[model samples]
Target chain A: MQISTEELPGGVTRVRLDGRMDIAGAQSVDLKMNIVAGSAHRLLIDLEKVEFLGSMGLRSIVIPARAVHSRGGKVVLFAPTPMVESVLKTSGIDALLPVHHSLDAAIAALE
Target chain B: MLGLLAASMPEALSAWPDPRLTLTSQLEDLALVLPWLQALADRYALTASTRFAIQLCLEEALSNIVRHGYRGRANQSITVECAPSPAGELVFTIEDHAPPFDPLAPSAADAAPTPQSIDELQPGGQGIRLMRRFSSRIAWEPTPSGNRLTLAFPLAR
Candidate 1:
């Protein structure tokens, strides 16, 4: 997986992930994601390009999201493909992280 | 890690003349699984949704075998066979030589209510749930050597 970060207005960090979020992909981004979780108080994970999501991929997201939560930070998922969204919902990660299809809605949630 | 093995039909599987890919029980071998599934999807003309479901279930099931069943050990054998059933469903059989464990059995993780918050969420145990939700049917049986898991999905015509 390829991860890139852009600073958005109002102190939110947009971390965009591109590639499959399967075992290898998740491992590739785990450390960087943790770093983002530690530093950013409001985080938006952009999933628009992620084509696949497996359980390990979910762990890669959940661990970081939990870290951000403990630090009083907010995290939201944005623009997952239909199959990826189904994986999120099936695992109930959608309920915890809150998935937003609209960029405006996702950024606003972090605010 | 050793190379993946191309398996011939075992006597038990003779009824289904399907392609088989066998790998060592290592997470790295998972990288090969998607391409294998993709080839099957292309050959069978499986719908995108069905393809996704099979991929999801295979990742979950195979990873579980590597992580939990084999305890992350390397060089142990794990075989996956893919075929279409007479009932118009695509079937996948995963056989692992690690131990006899039924992944489909109802457990505490299955019974636990969905966490309302991140703090309440458990770190693992979502793989089996994903398998159940994505596959049309799942069955597990104890093999003399270890365990076998079967996952089926209806072929979208």
Candidate 2:
């Protein structure tokens, strides 16, 4: 799993994941990003390149998103695959966070 | 992984270099380790027989290791070793210091799969059955110290 941050207009920071968002990726990437809870107000997580994400991967999103949410900040997950999106829906996480079908949608959500 | 492995990295699973790769007594760690296993197996182009069985068996084995082997000590550590034979048979070795009970010696009814109901057949005892289904061979070697399980599967095409 990899995370690279891209700054968009309107104070939106996009955290992109570019690999299998599995267990190893979850801990290494999710834990590190969750620390941004205090620092950032608006965040978008891009999971387009993630090949397969397991239940652990599903759990990883809750952390940073919730951390930011506590501060009244919002997290939008962008372009999750069908399977990953299914996991989110089954676990009720899709509703917990804002899910966008496209990067533009995510940016729009953040705006 | 194909890109990650090199002479420096050692593509062989047994000869794997990282220390973190060796310890897996914790379920949390298994959650960390399985993805790498799946990825490495995929990168190696492991066969479907190897992939599905090994993945399921490994998950079951690791779950057993966490629930029964380590007894959830939380502080305890377990060793997991994965190596392949020349014929592409994959051998996985897991050893833990839990009680010397053998999972194969007449698995207790309670030790069976997660049974679904009182009448209806459940998807239970999948652990033992899955181990049998996936691997051509499953052995439980007892030691004064702990239990050692060796599971072997054919490398995927």
Candidate 3:
């Protein structure tokens, strides 16, 4: 998995995640995600390129989202693929970390 | 020589065979799983959603075996076999040599009240829930040596 970040207007950081978010993928990004969450007040996790999501992947997202949330920050997931979205919904992580289908809507959520 | 070689080949090679994958208890072995599933999906013409469900459930099951059942021990044997059922489902059997544990059984985690906020959320327990929600049917049995989990998905749907 690859994680890249962009600084958007209004102090939001767009962290784009690419590749499968399976066990290995989750492990590969866990530390970086925590670091990003620790610093950014508003986080937008772009999942457009993520092809798969499993339970461990859910952990990778939830833990960071929680870190941001505890710090009074906001996190929004952006444009997960259909299958990945289903995993999010099924696991109910979508409730904790809101999912937005559009770039505008996603950035808006962080704001 | 060519005719003799052809006759010597196993007759089963002419037919489509069930697929099987084996791995050690190490989490890194998971890297091998998706590509194997992709091959199965191509061979069986599985729908994208079906393939995704299988991958999700298998990862959940296997990871649980490695982490909790085997306690992250390395070199333990784990095997996964995929076969088509007569009932119009594709069944995946995951067998492990760890001590018996029934993941499907209702546990404290299942009974715990749902978290109302991110503060209350627990990151690690979602695996069993995902397996339950995504699989068409799930069963767990204690094998003589360890445990076996069977997850089935409808071939059509």
Best TM-score goes to which candidate?
1
Q: B121 in model 2: Cα distance from truth in Å? A: 32
Error of 2 at B47 (Å): 11
lDDT of 1 by residue, B26-96 (tens): 99998888888887887777888898899889988989899999998899999999888999998999998
Ranking of models by DockQ: 1, 3, 2
Cα lDDT tens digits for candidate 2, A57-102: 6546666676677788878889887656654554445655778987
Greater-lDDT candidate between 1 and 2: 1
Q: Output the TM-score of candidate 1.
A: 0.91
Per residue, candidate 1 scores C-alpha lDDT tens digits across A4-36 of: 999999999999999989889999999999998
Q: Candidate 2: TM-score?
A: 0.51
In model 3, the number of clashes is: 0
The alpha-carbon root-mean-square deviation between model 1 and the true structure, to one decimal in Å, is 6.7
Model 3 chain A, poorest ten-residue lDDT window? A87-96
**Candidate that would win on DockQ:** 1
* TM-score pick, better of 1 and 2: 1
Candidate 2's C-alpha runs over 4 A off are: B1-24, B27-71, B74-157
Task: Indicate the residue-level lDDT of B143 in model 2.
Answer: 69
True contacts kept of each: 0.68, 0.02, 0.77
